[model samples]
Target chain A: MMLELISRNILHRPIRTFITVVAVAVEVIMVLVVVGLTHGLVTDSAKRVEGIGADVMVQPPSASVFMAFSGAPMPIKLAGKLQELKHVRYVAPVLLQFSSSGRLDIVYGIDPQSFALVSGGFVFHEGHDLQNPDDILVDDWYAKARNLHAGNSMSILEHDFHVAGVVEHGKGARLFVQLKTLQELSGAQDKASVFFIKCDHPDDATAVTDEIQQMLPRYVVRSLKDYMSLMTSSNLPGLQIFINVMISLAVCIGFMVIFLSMYTTILERTREIGVLKSLGASKAYIVRVVLGETTLLCTVGAAVGAVASFVITHVLVHAFPTLVILIQPEWVFRAILIAIVGGLMGAAYPAWLASRRDPIESLAYE
Target chain B: MEPILETDNLWKIYHIGKVDSPALRGVSLQIMPGEFVAIMGPSGCGKSTLLHVLGGLAQATRGSVLLDGNDLSNMQDAERTQIRRCKVGFVFQRFNLLPTLDVRGNIRLAQHIYGNEFDPHRFEMTTNVLGLSHRLHHRPSELSGGEQQRVAIARAIINEPKILLADEPTGNLDTANSDAVLALLRQLHRDLGQTIMMITHNPEAAAYAGRVIHMRDGLIVDGIPA
Candidate 1:
């Protein structure tokens, strides 16, 4: 009977219910999308780096795990010293440049022969590997995103380069150019941002990494096998904080809207509450009715929000082929939980006020 | 027979800011078991206030109220509420039926508050007696004022409370509907031996009761059988 009353009360005011549901849905969407996008991006980037087939990576001193933030500070000749190590078969000197011309991207400048030895070579889908200093090779995903093909002229870092090939994706970077050309363009001549090392045996990677760390104590040396574990939000700087702030904002939105909605509902039904009280309803019963209505609203809103997140993320990934949004089931559950907790907190005060109402005064309320 | 309901020098004062205005001033009353009693007075003469206090909906400022020998005046809010749920039923002037609930739902709500499992037999008997058997599914807005009051009465007496308190139960109805409702109350009193205490100003309505108590300035000026 109480459940019936609660549901009927919610349906009594359709417009108000809809607005409150939409507010909660928006909160769920905010949390899910923000977390999904960031997690997807980080995981996708980490997978691509592991796909380079390198057993060990060596970066300049104080360089960040995020390659885009690392400038070309290491001399190209450092690759020679790395190659001389016992388990190292090849070392590819690569220059990294951050580009923000039409969109944000990272450009890799590599010496084709040595990079091929370390990465097992790019599989060309349309053309060939980087052959000229002015030639550029774009991965399949980037080519589709930018609508580029072989023989198309593309500009990067204020230099025009011919599109030499469209390679299969999942390599280190989306756009690849000759190391010397990028070096000349960025005024970092003979300087490489990082080195990708291929080991004589895959099992020797840990030893090779330790040896490299000993050789250059201040430099960042990591084995490729451990890269995936380091891709989490906590491992990345500022990413977890960004997620927290977005979730907090979503919580605030859910909380304030639910608070106002339930407050007004109680005010409008003051006489009804009085009637219930007069009918022998206890304070706990009144509280249950109010909170039950809120819980129902939030549950419906959460389901809608979860479905909307999947739909919106699908559309987004479709429109931007290069963008990846992963909607994990756990995050969806967490988003729903956050919305419900927030809504309950929002309705707490209103429920208490309703429970504390004087039955006589409430009955007399106009 | 012992009194089923009694009040001793009941006083209810309304504190408006700093000014104290008394609504019920040292009024005392009693009703025996199975009695049909009417409280008659002009507006603001403490008729409704007395009913509220007797029903445990309001605490008296300076008095003791005994419902079935239980002192309600000194009880805590929860205890009073429990007593009201188990022993007292109220019908208001506005028909105070939850508009959101249909006739059946409104009636069942009282049973639910009483913490009893659904008693289909009692529910059917109550609805059948109130002439609401066919209007069970109708919302309050969809029912006539008379039908709504019948639903309210069914709800109040669903649990067979020890005392039924009606505060102008037919105030919102027309003369025809008012007569019909008063006739139903009289029938319930005569057939089921239900204890009823009603508050009304209309002499015709008061005539349905076996006894009438008249109030002036929150004090009972006349307490006699008519």
Candidate 2:
């Protein structure tokens, strides 16, 4: 019966209840979208790193910038030395050169069989194998974006080459070409940007990475996992600070609107609360009644907001493909947490005000 | 037998700045079980304050209110709430039935608070006695002022409290509904032996009770037994 009374009370004041719910929903949506977008970006970036097919990464001495942003390249001669080491199954030399359009373009030159082994097998849609030093498979995005189909000729660093086949993979660049073609075009002969070594055993890979590091103490030799961490850690500090500020700002504003709504609801129901108390409702019971009303409003509002935000996020990403904002399960969880905590915080003052009022005074209040 | 309600040297004072306004000045009274009493006073005579003190809803500046020989002043807030839950019921002139609840739910509220199930027969009898049988499904907002007061009465007495406190129960009703409510209260008192202490300023309202206590300012001016 007490629950029934509370339910009816909330239903009776539809306008006020709805307003509070919407307020909470708006907050939840904002938090969810923020978390979703950032999480998606991190995942996509990590996948990009993984696509390079290198178990370990080697960089020139004092190369502090990561592969994604670094302009420095390891000398191409380093591949033969790394390949000669024990436990090294195959080595593919990779070079990344900036396109005239300023996009990151990668070139992989390998003995076709060795390249196939490290990068998984490649399927050519139109062109011959990578045996022709000038043939290459470009990223699907780069091909479609430049209107270049397989067998179409394109120039990278002034050297001409035919597109072997358009490819899609999580690693390497979104754009790919032959390593020799890229190097010849860029006027860098007998020197490559990086080397990817596939090891015979997973455990031996770590030992190989450590040995390579010891051999070239001046250079940085890192495993694929290490490269991923470095990439995330480098950006995490800035991203975390940015996300925290954004979330805090959203919560503060959301709380203000929600608090106003709950406070007004309480003020309007002061007499009713007095009656309940006079009839033997304890302070705890009274708080529960009020909070039950709040919970109903917030949960509904947040759910609606989440759905709306999801659609909006999809639309935005479609309209601006480069934004790369994503929505994920973890993001939704964070949104819910924020909404609930925000609802409680918003309700705190009003619940206190309701509980603190003298029953006699409230009953006598006009 | 012990009295259902008792007050010993009760004093309630309201402070405004440095001025101490006494609402009830050392008022002491005992209401025996099954007795129907009315307290009459002019505006600001502290009748309502005294009722609040005795009901454990307000604290007195000094003195103690004992309900069934248990000191209200010595009880914690939760304990007082428990006492009010099990031992007392209230009927307000404004018919403070929750507008959200229908007549049935309003009446069921008291029993539910005690975590007790409703006795449907007892509920039916109470509603029939109060002439609210047809309005059980209607919310308080849908009922007339008199009907609403009747619902409030049903809710108060549904728990079968040892003492029923009515603060001007019929003060907001028309003559016909007022008489109807008073008739119901009298019948309940006589048939079930319910103890009632009602506060009202109306002389006719006070006359229905077996005893009347009149107050002036903060002190009792007249006390008469039927």
Candidate 3:
């Protein structure tokens, strides 16, 4: 009967239900998109770091964004010094170059055999492997957009290298080249931009990174996960703040609209409630009836909002390729909880007022 | 028969700013257990106020109401509510049926007030007796004025209260419907031996009761056997 009463109340006002549902849906969609952007950046950056196959990254001391993004050309001799460490099986020097178009891309030069060891499954898509000094492997995303593939020639810092083969990697930008070739072209024969170290034991990565950082206070070292977290914190904070504000605003407005709507309903039904009271319905029972109705409205509205949010997010992601609004299972569950809490909070005072009405006065009400 | 409801010089006064007005002035009456009584009066004669005081809906300014020898005037609000829930049933002139609830729900509402479990068989029997079985699922809006009165009867009697109070039960009905409703109340009195007190202005409606008390200026001017 409680459930039945709830259903009847919701069915009583179709227009009000529609308006509340739209409000909740807009809020949910905004929150989902914001959270998705944050998660996507963090997770994607982590995957990219893992693909680079560096257990740790060493950069200039106290250099946060600039060191990672700027990748200042370091002496190629650093790899040789790092290779002398006992746990280090092989060390590959990497260079990151910025094109005249201002697009940033990664370039790594290492022995093909050792590259496979450090990069895990990273390999050329076609053409000869990186055995010769002039060979370079470009990631598929970069290759497709730049109209450069295997056998095509491209210049980095006005130094030329042949694209030996195309490669596919994690969904981040990348371009690979032989170490000696990049060193010769960039006029950094004695320098390497960054070192990609392959350790015999993956667990030894932190110890190696720490040792390198300690050895040279001028440089910084980071585990792949930390690097990803740092990247997310700096790059995605604005989107997170925006989403939080949007969801908070929606909830506040939703609470007010739903609260006022339900209150007016209770006011109109005061006589009926009084009649019920005289008939033997307790104050608590009356409260339950009112709350039951609100819950039904909010639950149905939130469910609809969830589905609408999914559709809206999918469309937006398609329109803006870089922005993906992921509605995970957890997000759906949280939205439902929010709706229930919102419904209860909205209905409480109105139900109280209705229950407190005198039976005689209520029956006397027109 | 022993009196089921008795008031000793009940007085109900209202204060409006600096003015004091009395709705009931030292009115005293006793209603027997199985009697069907009516209080008839002009507007503002305080017949309704007397009924409200008797039903515990309003407190007396200075007096005492006794139910089965227990004093109601000194009880707390919660205690009065309990008494009202368990022993007193009320019917309004407008047939105060909750519009959102169907006939069955309206009937079950009485038990809900006492936090008592609904007895389906009792509900069915009450509806059957009230001739409202066909309208059990219909909301108050769908019922005619007379049918709404019948639903009110079912709700009032569903809990098997000690007394049923009706305030102008037939005031909204036409002549034929009013007669039908009055007849139903009379039948309920006969079949269940239930006690009832009704307030109305219509002498024709009052004629159905076993006794009628006439009031003017908050005082009873006449009492007659129907």
lDDT by residue (tens digit), candidate 2, A247-300: 887788667876787788788888888887888888887787767766767777
lDDT of 1 by residue, B11-112 (tens): 999999999999998988888989999999999899998999999988889988999999989999999999999999898888999999999999999999
Q: Rate the local accuracy (lDDT) of all candidates.
A: 0.92, 0.77, 0.75
State residue B196's C-alpha deviation in candidate 2, in Å.
Answer: 1.3
lDDT tens digits, residue span A1-366, model 3: 566566666666778767876766665655565566666655654566667676766654455533335545576667677888878877756655444534545555555665566676565676666667766777765676677778988877566778888777562336666767766665667665566777778798888878887787788677666766666534543656766676677677667767887898888887878776666566777888888777777777777777877787778766644343456789678867776687678789998888787877887788
- Which residue window of length 10 is worst by lDDT in model 1 chain A? A226-235
Backbone clashes in model 2, listed as residue pairs: A51-A171, A51-A172, A52-A171, A52-A172, A76-A191, A76-A192
| Model with the higher DockQ, candidate 1 or 2 | 1
Q: Look at candidate 3 and tell me the lDDT of residue B148.
A: 94
- What TM-score does prediction 1 earn? 0.98
Which candidate would rank higher by lDDT, 2 or 3? Answer: 2
Off by over 4 Å in 1: B224-226
TM-score of the second chain in each model? 0.97, 0.95, 0.96
Top candidate when judged by TM-score against the true structure: 1
Compare candidates 2 and 3 on TM-score and give the better one.
Answer: 2
Provide candidate 1's TM-score on chain A: 0.97
List, residue by residue over A55-144, the lDDT tens digit for candidate 1: 888988988787777888898889989999999999999999988888899999999999998899999999998888899999999999
Return the top candidate by DockQ.
1
Score residue A55 of candidate 2 by CA lDDT.
80
